[model samples]
Target: MIIFGTSSSTIHPAKLDGGCCPFCKTKNQMWIQGYRKYFHVFWIPFFPLWKKIYSVCSHCKGVFEKKEFKDQELTTSFEYFENNKIKIPWYHFTGIILVLLLIMLISILPFLTK
Candidate 1:
């Protein structure tokens, strides 16, 4: 999920422009690690999984948590069409085809041996 706001000096700006904080405006990149909580017993063994968030800033040197960064709206106004355009690359399709062919060959080989 993404959030966007603009910087303003008034009590409340309808939108946020871009707040300037020492760390928010820094020019550095770092990884922020967070934890994922499991609420059910189905995931008892891996109760907590570490999640890594990649981030880059222009002003701060240390890593910032997800809450620290202000969200920005993507201003792209393009209409998306729902045509049957292949999103995956050709190599990915080839890889999947190869895996399926190998599995089929393996199954047939066992039948032939009997």
Candidate 2:
């Protein structure tokens, strides 16, 4: 049996300077957290699939998805996260890198003999 599935990790959270939470009407209390989702085998990440961002209202302790955020400032803040928080960790491609090295070594081994 092969163990494979998907998992997500939280990216650095970003704070909105002038945004207000639609739920609590709190200004500058809204923050967004990004999750990097990837397919994994035996807990080793293969490659990233997609990213999801959610908003948290610090005052009200409410967590909401992109569709739930109706405030304009929060909407633009979500866009900022979608565009900027996409730094892929090197470990996410460990399987690919290992496979590539193996292929290269296999191809070069025969050439090196006699």
Q: Which stretches of candidate 2 lie over 4 Å from their true place?
A: none
Per-residue lDDT of candidate 2, residues 1-114 (tens digit): 889999988887778666788888888898888778988988888888887778888899899887887788878877876677657878889778888999999999998995
Of candidate 2, the 10-residue stretch with the lowest lDDT total is 77-86
Assess every candidate by TM-score.
Answer: 0.28, 0.85
Put down candidate 1 lDDT per residue, 1-114, tens digits, no spaces.
Answer: 433222111111022123333365532233222222222222222122232332333346444444555533201100011112112223323434566788999989988999
Candidate 1 TM-score to native = 0.28
Q: Output the number of the lDDT-best candidate.
A: 2
> What RMSD does model 2 have?
1.7
Question: Which residue pairs in candidate 2 have backbone atoms (N, alpha carbon, C) closer than 3 angstroms, thus clashing?
Answer: none
